[model samples]
Target chain A: MTMTNDAQAVLPPVPGLEDDDPPQLTPAQKKRATSRHLAFQGGTAGKLLGYFGMLAAVLLFFVPLYFIVVTSLKTHGDIYSNPISWLPNPFAPENYSYVINEVRFDKYLRNSVIITGILTVVEVSLGVMTAYGLSFLRFPGRNLLFLLVIASLMVPNQITVISNYALVASWGWRNTFQGIIVPLAAVAFGTFLMRNHFLSLPKEIMEAAELDGTGFFRTLFRVVLPMSWPTLVAFTLITVVNEWNQYLWPFLMSDTDAVAPLPIGLTQLQDNEGLTNWGPVMAGTVLTTVPMLIVFLILQKQMIKGLTAGAVKG
Target chain B: MATVEYQQASRIYDPSRPPAVNRVSLTVADGEFLVLVGPSGSGKSTAMRMLAGLEPIDEGTVLIDDVDVSELRARDRDVAMVFQSYALYPNMTARQNMAFALQNAKMPKAEITQQVERAAAMLELEVLLDKKPSQMSGGQRQRVAMGRSIVRNPKVFCMDEPLSNLDAKLRVSTRAQIGSLQRELGVTTVYVTHDQTEAMTMGDRVAVLREGVLQQVDEPTHLYEHPGNTFVAGFIGSPAMTLIDGATVSSDGRALLGPDHGLDMDLPREYAEKTPGQVIVGVRPENWEIVGHGAAPEDGGASMPLTVRLVEKLGGEAFLHCRAQETEGMTASVRGSQLVLRLDHGFKGIEPDTTIHVRPKPRTSVFFHPENEINLEYL
Candidate 1:
């Protein structure tokens, strides 16, 4: 009797049981009891701790963005004051215009748009085609080809920069749009992402399309691609962001502001002499960062949905 | 409509392992409904896939309308397939889904819409024509899949366990609907299923397979009454036929069964003449008749003692599960040495663990060869 009482004390009280009754349960009740015992039941204290951790993370990321905006709106005198100002004392809205006129921000913005546009279109199209070939098309040595594609992802871009620069220079493409966009057009990351998504789609649907008299390219464009909107949007956003902030390859390729992107153009705001104006540089940084931020904000939902697809099933 | 023929078609997935579908040859007359039935891994679905051109025919030729189509692509073969999962396009509306094939064939806009609307009306899916697959229920999606095939007017229809996903009640109604619809359209079809009941009820002629080999192909009633082998005998019936092994023919034209010849009865004259040394006897549940409690048979027939194990009362009829009391000389291959007897629904006063005597009705016992398990009547 005493041992039974001790066992009862260790077990949690079941919902519909009387306090005085012995704990004889049906199979369903026993299953519920075992799952309740094994699962983590977060109480009020754990929930509070979770909220506190989320608050800390939000503050950690938000503070640097706050500083960039505040410094971009501050005058040179306010920036160099003995005590740092979290808020601008004299709001200098002229810094944006000054950077736009003096630093040729308009020309840099145009070049950035043109380069990122062409790069994203080419990269995404090539990635979709390559991924479709790897996944759906049958050929000899197909597995070996896919393995090589995955292997290319492991070799860092920095390792290929010097050789790529030499090739571009030999072809007389230096300081040109082709020199910057052509070398980076073949993206292994986008191909890998799209290949996995394509593989997750039901193979029966593809067979159904084939029975409907659709050829290879029609099936890809009509059936396979229409159902792949989320992943396609995600790949496009990633490609745009990557090409927009690309600094190294573009810097190596471009010798002037004529074909350089936003990241390469941002460096021209900094003076070689020590007495450089800090206001316009910060304003130019803001100008370069905001467009990508807007694009991310607009496409953030689809990006997350695409990345998490196939992780859960109904 | 076109007749379909398979001339030793086979599909081998791996070189070292046995074929997924061994060489099978059969013919389906135009407008005939043929069902392929088997257990899992029995290659029923694989055979139908070969007909649909979804699976490669590694060994032989498949001809539709007297044209060899083994080398034809799936689209070129012009066969319509309804997958087990329905396989509807989630992004397209029901109208678009049904009209997809017509649009692919470059039909005019007016004709595509007209055919889609006609199919939707026939399937009672007029309200669902504007909805996507994700917004529809399972039965609705299944109807859309049917409509998709109907609008194509293809040469042959290949259905792979299409009704295996619905609820029990819905499966019954939809199966009836599909049967009547096939007759109305008079299209040649090859259906695949693992349910013996579905195969018996739906197919004009049923084909049974085992271990990637074709076992028997006959009309439903003929297949039931005359099974080619022990596998079909055991697999066809609901409660399954009980097979008793080690029974032998006596010197006086009587068959002796059980330990010490506890049960003996005269065999039919034709069967007794060809009887071998040892044979296996098969008796279905409905053929067993109750005599008395441990009493001699009044009709001068073979009677064996049975101890009741359990009774299942299923409203209209009751089944008594019994263990043969004198199974000492029976071979080990006899399934559990158990006997099943079907009784009327009003059967009363028979409880578990009671001993009773039962006998097979005249001319109801079928014998099989001991080694090969083939029906001796046919031999």
Candidate 2:
């Protein structure tokens, strides 16, 4: 077949916006045109507002923290003269030393360490086992049992303090580590968190492990635990913080400096100094707060995920 | 390694509702690939899980090697299952996932490595051995799941819709790969799927189930050619067999086609004698042929006088979607008088609104009683 130009038809002129080169415009006109497109297209103004908003939130949290740091460094004279000063007039690192000696801070630190350490380990382990059994195993009254666990969350710690104290006194556990740590570990929050995390796990993977000839404990430790490090870390961080800062239960239980955790020990400074010795009190507060702050900072990501894992479905 | 059997196995998930898997008895021979196929909620997966000892068999026994395994735990039963989700351990690498079962069994490290390596090589997953399941594609993850089961070397392999997770193209290719892989391993396998094509293509023998009841267990050719009932006949084929109900046989052996008396056809004496009242006549799409147009009956042969409502012309064949002019004799066979006729692609220039006379071949037609819908073939 021969090609022919006769087949080609003349093209009709098209209307509307056919110009390849943009029209020349004044700077003001260009500004108007560009601003119209930018206004609805994630305008720079909105992004600037977001950055400023975040900065405001950071400063809001940082101001009180800076005051605590300054107050902890201040001497008695400087603290009273201008209470809200940006910097301490005279630095007295010796206040921490005084508080440590007067409050028997060494014993208290040891007590806090032991109490928090045992509390975290027992709570996390029990939480994991309980969560695993509740999530994976099917038995009669499983959901009812889980509901009972969730129901425990509704019971405030204050209401049970007297009864728990009476029970501990009856067991001759007063001024003992068991009284303090055991009562704290009995809370259901950790189990609830860990159970929700386990519930979100794919059911088939657990079945696969069973068919692979893995026993219950082996599956829990090897398969479930390894995959759940985030939620584990999250629960551990929260538990450590809660155990370290525990006050009323330990205060009511521990009568001696040897058994009291940091929160109760910090109170000794208040009881002795009668509010005049704010320096040592703040210093003790800082000491108790710093270690948990470090833990929270390190595991902040997993902690948030663990805490919120209940609210979000997998 | 062993033959597996379900002797009247049943599972009731909730007491109020019907049993998920009703009493079902089936035997899968050693090294045989048996596929349990049904629609969703049809208890196919429940039956497979019962055999694997994952689901508790409520009222019957599941046996392996002629030993009742009903009371055994899933781990103690020594069976492995590839789940539909391809549930590879997310934290473990592909090699570790495949070797996990062996490790849990306390196999020697060298033996575990050897088995994993062999299975991985069979799956061609050498380069992906170190990759986590999250890092791999769906098909690759599926292979890793298969490799995990293969490393265990269990007595039976229970696969539940393993290919359902893959895309269409990948599903076809992976389906063939799993079929060949099962043949090579020769382990007694019980597979579950809702798709008829997968059941047909993959199984040595396919067991069709409906509403937790076993319909038939037969080879693919037998199931296709000789379904046991209306449900199996309608479900076994792609386009499905068109069943016209309420047809009556005259004393002269001429079977009336429709309730509207639209067409009449001759039936063999054996079938006509067995089916005296209202009967169901099943005709596959390909079996129907266009004989003549705009004419009444000459000799009494079953024919459908229909108007071509639509024409689907593929490159190699055409399906004439016709609608019966009258409503009376039309059964629920091909969706309310909309019958489809598959013809040669060479038949061109056919358009809608044209009339055609279609009849099923004599030997190919099957009859079922209208009330019970059971096959009349035994008579």
Candidate 3:
């Protein structure tokens, strides 16, 4: 009945667990460790050099980000002021405002959001469902269907551009978000990735779900899909990035600012004036790259795992 | 609870070829732990899979609680399966993996939590609950797998060599734990394993399968003592039931155990009453006795001469590898200190290459037709 702070600190000693006392170090071990430490002292200089080299390599990776951020914050004048500054000297936050308010950046943003979101949603949803069916469900022609996807991987996207454009145009989807998003859906890449992941899953788990009275959809929803978090994250990244940077398909179909996403919209900054406003163009580029960077950062752990799964032994 | 009735059920793994499991008529009662055991490539595993709805039945029906699940989907079958690989979700923590099925059942979150906690406690998996399959050790992961099965409360539990992946010591302990847990759970369980030790120690009844055919099904003791066939006789025991070729012996049931050596044994009525010709004789190693009252230490068993070869000591008991002078085979078995004969070293008591007389105790000897390999008779 007494709830005192000290008593609260006195936690219940767990049952079936023995307290683990740290191992005692003998004096000889201590001396050996000291000698090892002294040996490492000379190597410390080399280790510091290696650390700086790693630092340089890491900075090498961030150089693109630094360039984008600096360019995004510079004015057209600052961008061409004799030498383009490595960092924003006189920060022109106005470039963001200009892109945000003046340049139909809102339309570009909306278009990018609609196109990328629909593409991601459609591709991921269909990819996972189709892959689960192919990987786990046994039906005739399943292998043939999987092989078809693999075959599609060999066919260049550039080759499909003309046919896809014609099909969308025939359906009168030109200048619409559907024209941009629909074609990007049902991606072979996502299906391939997710299929491999599901196939790698231990069949016993699936059998257990089957015994638990889980139907096909229920098993997929509650078991297979949830366990494929790593694949989902990795495929999501691939899908988002592919859709975000998609230039050819969008540029081929859309003719106006209202329909075009950023990769196409950013081209408008490079007017036919024979000279370029590198500031807003780079600003648009920065805007285009930010969402994916944020997504990748959030899912780095899953990305690494999924990536390794592709090569690791079963 | 489930009473599994496999009436003429068979599994043809490759319909392009012969069936992996021939027509197997077997029934496992509710709460019975029946182990289907045999060497690799035996149809025992295929039979379990058929019961689980994982392997398609080529013929007849598998009735779980008298419901024919021949055409039913695996999910519709009320059986949980445990694989050798454990197969717990590698991505989810043990708790999540265990809860997956209950979650699908749409159990209230609180109920799911309580049931998961209960199963975890029962399996001693509380600490490992937050750990993924990859994070947990083999024994811990196996417990998590059992926890997943426990949460379901399914009608039948089908295990395919679930203890094989564990280290030897862990396997023994886990096998005992699982055996006891199955008793506590009181669910019908069809366990498939190649290890006869697991079958003998764990099963209420053990069924022996070989080459897609059911050999015999009986209490473990009965299987060992009264095997229905030569395969079962040999498969059910360690140092397997020693068999002597009957085709090379005499007509009055006297076995010529070696060159210039012969011993008279009465023909078992079971074999004599039937086809009275050549028959292989079966005897467990323990049934053998040395018959040299005034002979050397190298003497084997009564009437059978053996040359001492290698001896393996296991604390209290030692297995003497004694080669037969009459055949190409060697008798490997446990011998007490009084009976053991070694040539040299710390065990310098017995000599090597000396002829030792031996004989199998009467009535313990089983006779089989060398052609069919089936028991000469069953009593």
Candidate 4:
């Protein structure tokens, strides 16, 4: 059983090694290869175009934010000058003091915090429970109930404003925190978002939990909720921003400074100062915008991940 | 360990369509391992779920140790399940996952820790205790899943295709491990799989299901040797038994096979009497004996010419796939007109498109009535 060179002598030459020249490719094949190479490298021109598009998007969104910050620091005279100043000259840092101390912005900030905090907590909790029930629980008309939940999303909020205002007014709930918080606490969008995310989770995990002797609530807290942090955080962030910026319903519901949120307090400030005073008003706008901006910046990565949870499989 | 029984248990997901699991009655002895095996849509998993209390038994009762548990919730049934996907808690460490059921049962923390450590040692998962499911390989995660159910020490273990997700090489080793572990535990277990080889090698008794109906339940050797009908005959064995249809019974009481009537054999009197005009002859791959090339019959056995189409050499054995020359112009059987012959490992010199002669060994062929597809010998 000796190995021999005779076998190699009879073996045919490899197909491309018969000649030194590389095998010729058809035009279509050459084109495909070049395109594939370009795609892998992301082509220099395409990379430049992509960067330029991103720059345009940044400028488009940030310009208004830049205008607000600059206007907030400008003096009353500088704001209305003939040559529009893009930068604040002797930055009127006193404008923030005027809005905070003179206009009593602390009360409105307290009201906003209370309303937004309670609303976000209540809405997110209810959303999670409702989504869990709709996705996991067995019932007679579960699909029909889910349909009703989704159908509510199509209804415009403005159409229900009059009825909500009438109902709150009749109960003598005007100018109260409950009046502003109660109606908005029933979350439809959050329920829909959370339900889709829950449905995307493997159904076998819940079944496994049941076989492990876990009740629905324990399973929800221990097994389900731990895996759903991204969506829950996203839902909470959205709810906080929406409730904090809520204007029309609160304006109709609250008549006094006692329960009026920041949005309503901004209008009160405007009414007191008249149209000529722009510095303090811009300062107040910056104050209201900054809190949400900070929140968004801190949690933006998780918020994006949560929003696109079920759109693609990992 | 406890015995489990299904008294006509059925699950109907939709009223208009056929039941997912039709009325299926089976009984498992204490400490026995029974495998429910079928194709993808054959309701094997549904039947196992019904016993686990994960699925509602729409029509009949399922009992554990003589206690009816049809209305019991999954958690109350005291049965553990290993899902096809492993279904380990992605966020929990392996130790935590195995300890979760004990925690829910309100077992003392010290006892839970001891139980988890013991199960981990048995599964060889000591180093993997702190690793999450995502951090472990597929095989490690599977072992953790097995440990989770073993830690429970429930009355019954329901495993739904637990090895289906592993790589081919790993599946074979894990298959042996699971079999040996089940033997050591000696719990009444019901395992579901679509792989016939897995079912045959693992179960003490394998139950074959088709379209939500139990086809046959028997020991592996018994099921392989004596399948009740054509479906079992064609499905149980690898390469499968080639069934030639349009076989007829001559007026002389001889079983005539092939379109040209090239082969004839004496059938049992009871079988020959029951055959209506046509019969189906089933012959296992190993049962075929290669006679000679273009030679006449020597022992008066039926023989047919075959054209070798492919030769598969599997080191220890070879399977020759050939087309029946006699049945060339006839209507093909359910498995087509190809006949497979299993040969010894040293068999050689056969190539594609070469001609050879083969015949079913004496008394090795099973006869079936063409219309009903029932084994005539059984009838």
Docking class for candidate 1: acceptable
Off by over 4 Å in 2: A1-56, A100-102, A137-145, A170-172, A301-314, B14-17, B258-266, B292-303, B327-335
Off by over 4 Å in 1: A1-41, A301-314, B258-267, B293-302, B327-333
- Note the B-chain TM-score for every model: 0.93, 0.93, 0.88, 0.94
By descending TM-score, how would the candidates be arranged?
Answer: 1, 4, 2, 3
For B1-379, candidate 2 gives per-residue lDDT tens digits of: 9999889889999889888888899999999999999999999999999888888999889999999999999999889899998877777789989988898889999999999999999999999999877678888988989999999999999999998888999999998999999999999999999999999999999999999999999999988988889999999987778877677776666567544454554456677667656678788889887777667446655466788889887767778888876645544344356777788743476678987777776578777877788888754
Using all chains and alpha carbons, the TM-scores for the candidates as numbered come to: 0.91, 0.87, 0.81, 0.90
RMSD of 2: 5.5
Say which prediction, candidate 1 or candidate 2, comes out ahead on lDDT.
1
1 or 4, which is superior by DockQ? 4
Clashing pairs in 2: B259-B329, B265-B301, B265-B302, B266-B300
Listed in order, the DockQ scores are 0.30, 0.37, 0.25, 0.39
Better of 2 and 4 by lDDT: 4
Using alpha carbons, what is the TM-score of model 1?
A: 0.91
**lDDT tens digits, residue span B1-379, model 1:** 9999999988999989988888898999999999999999999999998988899999989999999999999999989989888888766788998998899999999999999999898899999999878778888888999999999999999998999989999899999999998999999999999999999999999999997788889999888887888899888888888887777776665566843464653356666667566667788899888887655556765567788999887766789999977546533234667778898743466789988788787778777777888887788
Compose the digit string of candidate 2's lDDT tens values, residues A28-107: 88878878855444558988888899999999999988877788888888888843667887778988888777778989
User: For residues B263-309, could you state the per-residue lDDT of candidate 4 as single tens digits?
Assistant: 66446666777877678888899988888655545666446778889
Error of 2 at A204 (Å): 1.6
The alpha-carbon deviation from the true structure for residue A270 of candidate 3, after best TM-score superposition, in angstroms, is 1.6
Q: What are the per-candidate TM-scores when only chain A is compared? A: 0.82, 0.81, 0.79, 0.84
* Candidate 3: residue A219 Cα off by (Å): 1.7
